[model samples]
Target: MEYSIEDVAAARSLQFAKYMYTSMATFWTYDYACSLHEEWTFLLRSHWSKMKGLYIATRYLPFILLITNLYMSFTPNENLVKCGMLVNITSGLGMILAICADCFFIIRTYVFWNKNKILLAAIVGTYLSFVVASVSIIVDTTASAAYATIPIPDITGCYQSSTSDQIFIPFVLFSVFGLGLMILTLIRAIHSWQRNQSHLYVVLMNHNILYYACVFLFSVMNIFTSLLLQDSYQTVLDGVQFLALAIIATRMHIHLWQTNQHLRGSSGLVHIRLSDMSSVNVTA
Candidate 1:
């Protein structure tokens, strides 16, 4: 049997999305496996705290999402309503996952600034603004996502008939937020360098800068793809981006905890203990 050009394109796009899911599953498996020992030793053995709760959520929520997304892409489902509902569920979860990952930056930066109230206020204010705006935009745009049953050759999943261009706004907001965080971190990084040139200080600085750079790059890539592409292609980077944020953020927390425990740090670095990092009083 023959198919129309549009049908062929749709099939190819769905195929590409399947490839994306395959890659995400592969990466997630490898990343989670490699970190299991660290998680058991550093996280499971540690005392509980609100910060630990956030880290656990950030680390594990994506595993739930990965399962759902796999079901969406690979499983045989033709109900448009179910497809739309799954999309909404995943999108909302992804937004929440993003905030969870971002909290690490907020907490770490607050600690990096030596828990200065003024700097903490500045960062928290900007972050809350971004959060409010992104929540409003994502809620509005997610409602606009429409799906249809794909009746074409070689396609097993429902096709995303339409998604709002405004969906890109959240990515844009996040990119801006990430850039600001990186800027603040770099500025403070200079002060840290001059204040105390300890090995612990160098390690912390290296982790922040390098990981922030990676997250920032992926954010930009997401913005462009979400803005320019349509249908399945629009979200090709979504899984990888989320995984990047999760893996990098968790690594930052774990490495810091281990460093603090082992080195006990010089005067410069010891003040920023892992337990105290997330105790920033945003209300004050």
Candidate 2:
């Protein structure tokens, strides 16, 4: 039978949807793969640490998300769409990464402020609360029918949920975590600078500030765009958000290493100056 204008329009919409999914699949795969390689390389080369494990776990999340997006792009079956919905649930990995990094920050704070019990406990307690909230959202949203039942035109192709649920709790949790830890870190660094003028304090504080600032900004932007924009645009926003985070973290890491090296050189000069002063005083 011959098709009419309405049929042609419907066909065009499906084709457009397929193309959109295809683009998402391509970008996320590349973004996550690069992250996976970077995290794995860092884990293997660096000293064993909790932060490294956090990075490794984080590095795998995008890959898993891409897989779910891919399933949606390719699968047309309504029943299996539920399975794809489950995969989208795994995107909470990003939120988990934020929590893990915050925990590491708290531990670092404790180590640096070993003399201060109250501050350390507060940081630890706050991070734990965030972890609890994030877990709740991930569990509840992924299990709902709302995720799996979005209608598709045909029964023959892949259907996927375009995005995760609102899940505002995790975003709010991380934003607070980043902002609070950032302020705490700055205060401790200022205290260290006043007491000993240790350059390590400056270097570390700067890195921490930039790292979490990026996380905080990205989290907010992602939340706004995902909540307000079209589903098609959300995929692009996701990729951009991930890219910004990766760049910020990598740059901060390099900055810290360089700053530490410079500080060591400066410390050597101070030691030499003190040695010369002692000799002059002894000779006089």
Candidate 3:
């Protein structure tokens, strides 16, 4: 039996996706190992704050989800139903974790802008709407997915499948939402830098820029992969995007916490000058 070019391409694409996800998982695991000291010393021992829950979710939840993904990617495709369940579970959790990361960014952004209620209301409102739309679209798509074990050789995937093209809607929506956040962050970041080019302010600006840059790059990659790639199993780089953001954002908060502690009294991190912020880790 000879395989056509399309079959071969699809099989190869699926294989490549599996490899990419595995590599990403490995890289994140290694990063987690390296950050254990910081996690224990800074986040674990410190008193909790409102943002602490988000911090933990963004920081450690990936390990659990990444492990689940590895099982889905490598497991035999004997039971399509089981595979489908895994796919849906991981995808949904990944979205929620990414949502947590987004909210964490929002908190940081709001504080950076000095807790502007107007800005908070606008951004939060838009983000809430986006979340609702995203969740509905993803759930509907997952429920309606036509899961099948690809006929091509070397494409052993658990519900690692061609989902409804409508699945791309959430990815597109998220890309747009992220773009809006980027615009707001930038406009304010510029003003902040011009007003006072303090070292701490510069650090805050740099880290925020890092998060936006990562979000922009990965969001585009996710949209493209979801739309065009044949074996775009597990929505590919969405996990990568959240992982990158989690690492960057969490590290920023930790560094800022350390800096605030070192400075003794000033609220340089996001400029939140409250008595509680001095003792607790609140830089989400």
Candidate 4:
């Protein structure tokens, strides 16, 4: 192979062009993920207040964090943007929601247990740890002010490495804790159903378990995909997560409505049957 100086220069230029194209593609996919996040957030917000306030808050908090993450990914002025503050607010609100849910579950479990203080305490303690971990993540993310000067390493965006590590550690811990809690809840529900077998209770409990399980599993998978795969893969993951959540939630909501209607009809029929029986006896 004979190559002139011009040929060497041409090859180098081609390689550079390819590298730039790849980088641009990754950035595009990353931006697309942010857009999807915003889209899903808006959809969920539109449905807010339909369920209890808890549902409204749970959907809102994560969407807000998704927005903050989107902003950080797009912005180049690391020192001028208050992105870290946004993250802090998002995580803090999320932690509050988690704690509230924890309290609600603890109370329900206590009532179901006939005020077993020990079991209640254990469950509460475990959830408290979850809340604490979330709060720690909030604190760490906040420690690195969005407007503060931070080193920008590569095209991945601006982040203070030291503080980010602290933030990530607590985030991982909280996620793990959440997964464990979901599993425990599922097990407890199964046992409760086996003991008494109330159809209504069982149905509700299973729906609740499935909802939490999807939340934990998909959320973890989304995070993992974002961290490990190329940015293109992230776009795919974002799409998958959004569609999965939407489909599952919608289905559950529809089924709940149907179940309620059926129950109401059954109750009415029972009332009519008792009335007819009483009327016949009076006639006799």
TM-score of each: 0.89, 0.63, 0.85, 0.51
Q: Ranking under TM-score, best-scoring first?
A: 1, 3, 2, 4
Greater-TM-score candidate between 3 and 4 = 3
Lowest summed lDDT across 10 adjacent residues in model 2 is found at 275-284
lDDT of 1 by residue, 227-258 (tens): 77767876657777887788888888898788
Candidate 2, residue 72: lDDT: 50
lDDT of 3: 0.70
Clashing pairs in 1: none
Tens-digit lDDT track for model 3 on 46-93? 667667777788788888888877777776666788877987888787
Q: Using TM-score as the measure, which candidate wins? A: 1
Candidate 4 achieves a global lDDT of: 0.46
Error of 1 at 104 (Å): 0.9
Mind giving the per-residue lDDT tens digits that candidate 2 earns over 1-284?
A: 56566444434434554566566567656655666664455446555554455544544555655555555545654566555453455356445444444543455555556436797677778777777877777566555523233343452332234445655566677777888777877777777665545455555566677767876887787678667754434444554555445445543443443454455565543221111111101010
lDDT of 3 at 265: 56
Sequence-dependent TM-score of model 1: 0.89
RMSD of candidate 3 to the truth, in angstroms, is 3.9
79: Cα error in model 3, Å:
1.0
Pairs of residues clashing in candidate 2: 75-157, 75-158, 75-159, 76-157, 76-158
- Runs in model 4 deviating more than 4 A are 1-51, 59-81, 94-117, 144-163, 179-183, 186-195, 215-258, 268-284
Most accurate candidate by lDDT? 1
Q: Indicate the residue-level lDDT of 10 in model 2.
A: 38
**Model 3, which residues run further than 4 Å from truth?**
1-7, 150-155, 159-161, 265-284
